[model samples]
Every structure is written in C-alpha cells, then in structure tokens.
Target: MENKNKYIILTTMLIQSTLLIVINCTIIDTSTLEALKSSMPIFNIMILITTVLMLLSLKKANSFIKKETELELVKSNMKNTEDLLNLLRTQRHDYLSHIQAIESLIILKEQEELEEYIKGISKEYRITNEMIRLGNSVLTAIINTKKEIAEKKGIVFHVRCKNKVSLHGINSWELSSIISNLIENAIEEASSIENEKWIKITISYVYNNFVFEIENTRKINNEIGDNIFKPGVSSKNAAGRGYGLFIVKNVVEKYNGSIEFKTTEKNSIIFKVILPSEDGAYGEKAI
Candidate 1:
C-alpha cells in the first residue's frame, strides 16, 4: 500500500503538470505558440521520458524503504532474541540441579517419578532444539523464535531439515524475512481452528532452488484463497492480519523466485517458496 500510494500520487502530479504545461503553451502569443508547435512533439516525448524515469526512481525508492524496514525488524528480533536467551539461561541455571534431583530420586528407588521427570525434560528439550543444525544461523534464529511464539499459543511447530540447506546467494536477512512471515501466518491460521493444530516446516534443495514448505492444519476460506497474497486479504476477519504473505510474495518475486501453495477443505495448507541459488539469477542483487 505504501508503494501503491506513491505511484498514485506521482501519476496524479504527472497528469496535473502535463495539463498545466499545455495550458501555459495555449496562453502564449500566437507567434510564439506557432513556434512551440514544431517542438511540441519533442516536448511531449521528453515529458513522457521524464515521467517514466520518475516512476522508476519512485519504485526503486520503495524497494529500498522495504529493505530498510525489514532490516530493522530483523535487528529488533535479534535483540529480543538475545534477551529471551538470557532469561532462559537464568531459568536453566537450575538445569544441573534438576538433573541431580533426578539422580537422587533414582538412588532412592523412585523409578516411576524419575521416569516422568525425565520424559518432561526431554519434551522441553525437543521444543527448544526443534531444528537440526542446518549450518544456517539466520534460519536457525527465525525458527527458534517463531517456535517459542507458536508454543505459547498452543501450536505445535516442527522442522525437518536433515540435509544442509544453504541459501547460496540470498542475503541472510532476506531469507529470514521470508521464513518468518510464512510461518507467522501459518501460526495465525492454524491457531484459529478448534481442531488439532500443527505446523510443519521442511527445507531442502531441489537442485538450483532452495525450497521452503510450510504445512499447517487449517482450512482457509475459499473467498480468500484466490487473493491470499494480495495486500489486505485476510481470513482472520481483522485488520492488520494480512501483510505477512504480501511481503513474502514481494521478496520472493524480487529474486525472480516463485511462491505457490495448496489448500484443501480437509484443513491443510502448504506454502512452497523456491528461490534461485545463483547470484543475479532472478533479481538485481539486493542492496
């Protein structure tokens, strides 16, 4: 919408300026008006070229604004993540004590209680260490933070990346925005349903493109299915619930990437983004 508004304003100003120029020309003395006629074609051509260049400049400005906004968001997320980790570390200071207690319980022949306690700790560890060591720190940070958000909302978040998935030429922040937005939307949609809610993310390399598949157990309304990526389209029935996918679509397209999804009436939605791995494969190298 920000870019759209700029385009509209630029276009309006262009039309107004063109009209004013023509009016000024009409009011000139007849001899001068006649002299200007021969140059009218050239003047109009120049105006057209200027208009095109101005629009291009505006579009480039919009892209830079978006990049800066996403960068700030990433920095904010990283800071909050640092705070969250510190808090977790503080809480986990008792981790060793908890293990000692379990050992003491075992020494006291309390098999049943020790078993339950160990199982609980194991589950917690699973949630905290959900993703494999995929050698991509940016993606790891995104999944960790998003997983915490999902768990707090009673949503099950799972990641499957057994093999290495490197974003060959994409900026870490760019990939971070893409992954964060997709999973964030999935969490929102899946949490709305009354039935079982879960989100699964799988990352793999299909040769030239790195693919991200986020599957969730929520049925999207057909009304929204057609325009899901269009800005302001949301099934959540609330304002500010629709920008994630729109941003995802824009970034994916900027890289000459493709974003596709499959939704079913059976309460399942899968979004797949395939981005080229080679630098300059699709877009002007992101600044």
Candidate 2:
C-alpha cells in the first residue's frame, strides 16, 4: 500500500513537472529552449526510472506481506498440533499409570486402597477442570489443557483468575499461542533446575489492569543473553527451535501489554505481564 501511494505521488509530480516545463517553453522566448533542453530530458529520464523503481518496490512489498501472512498461518497450525500432541501424550501417560496402579492393588489385594486411589485421581481432575472453567470457552480449554500437561510433567501449576476479564478483541488462537509459549518455556526452564521445579500462574484484574504472572525455578547464575528474545536466538543448536520467546514478545506487544523477566541469584525466574482491562483488550477470562 505504501509503495502504491508513493507511485501515485511520483506520477502526479511527473505530470506537474512536465506541464510546468511545457508552459515555460511556450511562454519563454526561443533562447530559453536551449537552456531547458539540457535538463528536461534528464528530468524525464529520472521520472521514468523512479516509476519503474516504484513498481518493483510495490511488487516486493506485496510479496513480503503475502509470505508473512502465510508464515503466521503455519505457525498457528503448528501451535495447535503441538497442543493436541501434548494432550494426547498426557492421556497416554495417565492410562499407563492407571493400569500400573490397578495391577499393584490387585497384587496387594487392597480393594479399599484401589478405590481410594481412583477417587483421588478423580477429585484432582475435577479440581483441574474447575480452575480453568473461565467464562470464555476458548480460554477455559487452553488453561485446562495446559494444566494437564504441567501436571503430567510433575510441575506444580497454580492459577488465580476472575470472571471479569474481557476477551473481545483477542483471537482465541493467538491467546493460546501466547499463553502456551509462556507456560511451556517456564516448564522447560524449571525442569532444568535441581530444586523442586514449579510454575505459578496468576491472572487477575486489579483496578484497571489485567495482570498475569508466571514464575518458575531456574539456576541462579544462568545469564540469559540480551538478545535471547531475538528471532533465531536459541539455546538449541538445531534449527527451528528458537522462535518461541520471540513470538511471545510479539503477541504480548500486539495487545499493548508489557512483559518483564526477573531472576534472583539463588532463587527463581519470574515473568510478569500487565495489560489494559478495557473492553476489547487482550486478557484471560475467569471460568
């Protein structure tokens, strides 16, 4: 669009310049024609060259926009597939655990213990269901799904949300992308620590702000490079693995929200996000 506008401006300027030159040639005496002749062809040639340049620029701009949009769609699909795979993996692991528990109970002949074990699992699932049952269905699904993954990884995950969050302008998929990337990074970083690794996530409305925080354990002296969030800046040596935090930053900034990271020498790393709570603003709604 910008390139097209520039082309239009250049075309107008060319017309105006040509008209001015013609008027001067007609109004002035014959002597001025020789003076104008030297510069007029050069000016016309420049106008033609600029027109061609504008066309090329517009074509390149259009191609770039199309490619970017396609890449975004691909990323969105990949995130969905990853989320589904995580869910499936959690269920598979749980099924194996259930079978093992039943087998152990059968060998020990502990009917009461087996029943109690099943009941305990059921209760925990119920609690998980309730924590993410927000007013918005999409957020509810995202939180609950991520909660299951966190539990499967033995990562202590916590949530505190209210029903007043407005999700008007934010797309469900983008929100999923943002939260999923944040939580996944937290889990991965926490898992690297030797201590009791945990991730605490809180979403709440305070005054006019909607606040979200995810904190997890990490090594004290781990120096995250200044360019850690840049695209392609990955701890992984392999390709295509380092874009998570870069996308997270982009999504957060898209909604006029801000995210900060803090680390203590011997403590934990915390990521805090604060966004406006106005209608149509991006935030997680309480179930």
Candidate 3:
C-alpha cells in the first residue's frame, strides 16, 4: 500500500510536469517554451527528490506504527496469560512450607536455628520485594522469577530500587523480555565464574526516561563489549544463540528508547536502558 501510494504520487507528478511543459511549448508562447526547456529538468529532479524523501519518511512512519501495534498486542496477551500467576503461586506455596518449618523451629525451641532462619527469611523477602518495588507488576514478576533462578544457581542478585516506578505506556511483554533476557545473560555470565558471582539490577526514572540497568560481576572482553548489541555475537560459545541483545535493542527502539553499554569499574559490563514513559515519572505508588 505504501509503495503503491508513492508510485502513484511520483507518476502523477511526472505526468503533470510533462503536460505542463507540453502546454507551455504549444499554447503559452516561445518565451515560456524556452524557460520550460531549461527549468523542466530541475523541476523534475526536485520533484523526484521530494517524492523519494516523502516515501522514506512514510516508510519509517509505517514501521514505527507497526511496532507500536505489535507492542500493544503483546501487552494484551501478557495481561491474559497465567504464567506469572502460576509462578507466583508456586512461590507462595514454597513460602507456606517455609512458614511451617519456621513454626516447627519455634516449637522445638531451637533459639539459634530460629534466629538464623528469621534472618535468612528476612533477607529473602527483601530481595523478592525489591523485584516488584517499581509498582509495575508485570516487570516485577519477571525480575522476581529471574532473581529466584539466579539464587537457585548460586548467583547473587541485587535490586537497587526502593520506590515504585510508574512505567506508564510501556509494553509489559517487551519490558519483561528486556529485563528477563538481560538478567538471564548476567546470571549465565556470572555462573561461568568460580568466586564472587553477583548480578545487580537497577530500575529508576530519571531525566524523563524509565531506566533499567544490569551490572554483573563477570569480566567482559573488549570485543564482546563493543559489538554486544549486534546480532549473532555472544561470549558464550554456541552456534545460533546470540539473539538476546538483538531483541532487546529491537524493543528499545520500538519504544523510542536508548540503550548504553559501559564497562564497570570492576571490569564487568553493564547495560543501561532508558525508555520513555508516556505519563513521565510518578511518585510513591508501591506494588
């Protein structure tokens, strides 16, 4: 449809310009004919350039609109899905078991054991709440699940957000996708190391953008760090695998967002994404 419109506009311009020149030569006068003969080519050239630019602009607009539509559909599907609910249900069931164990510890009068259990549970609860602290329930579930996976694999996970973020007008699925893939990548990279493995996640709304950042403890090579967002590039040596950052970049661009890569002071790499929030930033809405 876009191409057809461009073609029609271009063709109409060419035909109209041609007939104008013909009309000038046949009916206007000799002076007008001479003027048309010299200026005609420039006119056509200008018209062609204008048409081409218009077509390019229209193409870009179409792509952006399509991406927005896809983002909306993804958000809708995500809202209707049961995966997050099921995940939380499982976590809740596990928490019940923890509660039972704590009760038994209390009844048995294991003072030292109960104290240690209380401390451990407090730390775990803090980490879990940090995941959803941003008030975006969808993003929270994703971060929570990933944190759980990281802990299960002996990877330390950290979330540095205290206030709930208002991630208004962002697609939940793509947002979840971005958060999940980055955290998973961080976990995978940190898991490859032997000691001091940790992944730190930060969510903030600053400078008119909702920021999502992931910094891990694994060292990154300059080569991988430089071309990290490119498709088919991965530090993990496996064929047909490196689409994580590629998809991440795709989603960020769809939302008119920006992503930055930096090598942290600890020689590890960090990915910082700044996405536009339609309602801008908000205050104190805990999830």
Candidate 4:
C-alpha cells in the first residue's frame, strides 16, 4: 500500500511537471527555449537523483520491516519451546518421584501398602488437575512450573491473579517472555540472599489497563544506576550478556505501555507494568 501511494504521487508529479514544461515552452520566446534546452540536462539529472533516493529509501524501509517481523516470529517460537521444555522438565521430575515411591512399595511386598501408594499417586494427580482449573492454560502451566522450581529452591512464591485476563492486545509470545524473564530474574536474585527469599506477583485488571507487579527480595547496588534496562548492563560479569531487561522494555513499549522500578534501602525491589487494555484504543477509556 505504501509503495503504491508513493508511485501514484510520483506519477502525478511527473505529469504535472511535463504539462507545465510544455505550456511554458509554447509561450516563451526562442531565447527562452534555447535556455530551457540547455538546462534540460540539469533537470533530468535532478529527477534521476530524486528517483534513486526514493527507491533506496523504500528498499531500506522494506528490509527493516521484514527483519523486524522475522525477529518477532523467532521470539514467539522461542517462547513456545521454552514453555514446552519447562513442562517436560516438570513431568520428568515428577516421574522420578513416582519411580522412587513404586520402588519402595515393591520392596515392602505388602499388598495393602502397594494399594495405598497407588492411591497416593491418584490423589496427587487429582490435586494437580484441580489446581489447573484456572481457565487460562498458559498461565496455569507457567505458574505451576515456576511454583515447582521455587519450592525446590526453598523460596516462597506468591501469586494474586484475577479470575481471567484479556490477552487480546498482547502477543502470547511477548507476554510470556516478559513474565518469564522477570520471574526468573527475581528467583535468581532472591536465591542468593542468606535470609528467606520470596517473590510476589500480582496481576489485575484496572479501569483501562492490565497491571502486573512483581516484587522480590534482592539488594540493589549503586552499580545498577539508571542504566539497568540498557542491553548488556547486567552485574553478572559475563560479556555479551544482560539482554533480559532490554527485551522486556522493547516488548512493553511496542504496545505503548509503561514500566517502572522501585527499590527500597532494605533491598526489596518492585517492578510494575501498566499496559493498555487490549480492546481499548490509545488514550481511550475502557468500557
């Protein structure tokens, strides 16, 4: 569409220029015609230069758009793969526990104990099934997977999510990326503390925005400064690292949303995100 508009505008301009040139040529004297003919080469050169520049600009713009689209698709696929891997890991870990329980029960050679072990497994399955009744499968899967990891690390993970959320405006891949990275970072930082570590996440729908807040226990040093979101600015000492916050900022800003960070002297950090409702237009109120 943009290319077509540009072409139409250029064609219109060329036709108007030709007509004006003809009209002026017919009304002008022979001296003027000679001068116009002599200046024809310059005019042609200018037109050629303009056309080249326009085409070059269009090509560059098109390339950039294509590259951006490709990057987005790759990011989406990566998120899907990550989610699948997390699920698989959880299942594998659970399977190990089941194997251990079965091995112990078989060695006891007691029929009653064997039946009880099977019942225990059934009860565990029922509990998992009940917990996943939250309606949003993605959210349930992610929360359950993370919960397991946090428990394994002896960190307290708390969640306060509303019944259902409008996922319309946001791409699932980008949303998952943002949430996963933030939670993972919180967990990692919290685990390093000597005292009890905790991460709290709250997701709620307010007026015309979907608000997400994550708080974690971590000491923020002066090294973070104002460049915490800058790519490759991580305190983790490895070169070519620190792109998590950069990714989060890019995804949030794409939807005209806002994110902020607050840190207390006591080493508690809170990250808040306010995104426009998917069904609402920019600067418009939600119904």
Off by over 4 Å in 4: 1-141, 280-287
Task: Mark the 10 consecutive residues where model 4 has the least summed lDDT.
Answer: 278-287
For model 1, the superposed segments whose C-alpha errors exceed 4 Å read 1-67, 76-91, 99-120, 129-131, 279-287
Residues 1-287 of candidate 2: C-alpha lDDT, one tens digit per residue: 35454556566567657756765665474466676577677667767776776676677667777667557845764565567556657666787788898899989999999999988877855643355555655556566666767767877777777644566666666666667777878878777766687888777776667677878877433444566678987655677877887877887788888877777665777777776655744354455
What TM-score would you give candidate 2 relative to the actual structure?
Answer: 0.61
Better of 3 and 4 by lDDT: 3
**TM-score (C-alpha, index-matched) for candidate 3:** 0.63
Top candidate, metric TM-score? 1
Which scores greater on lDDT, model 2 or model 3?
3
Local error of candidate 4 at residue 221 (angstroms): 1.6
Clashing pairs in 4: none
Q: Distance from true position, residue 279, model 2, in Å? A: 1.7
Clash counts per candidate, in order, are 0, 3, 1, 0
Using alpha carbons, what is the TM-score of model 4?
Answer: 0.63
lDDT digits (tens) for residues 1-287 of candidate 4: 35454564566567557756764665574466686677677666766766765676567668768668657845754665476466666766897888887888789777798888888877765434434323345555566566657767988887787645565777766777677777878888888898969988887777778788989898666678578899998867888878888888888998898888889776789889888886643342221
Worst 10 residues of 1 by lDDT: 278-287
Candidate 2 — which pairs collide? 133-287, 134-286, 134-287
TM for candidate 1 is 0.68
lDDT of 1 by residue, 93-168 (tens): 8689888999899899999999999898878766444443555677766777777788888998878874455566
Candidate 2 whole-model C-alpha lDDT, 0 to 1: 0.69
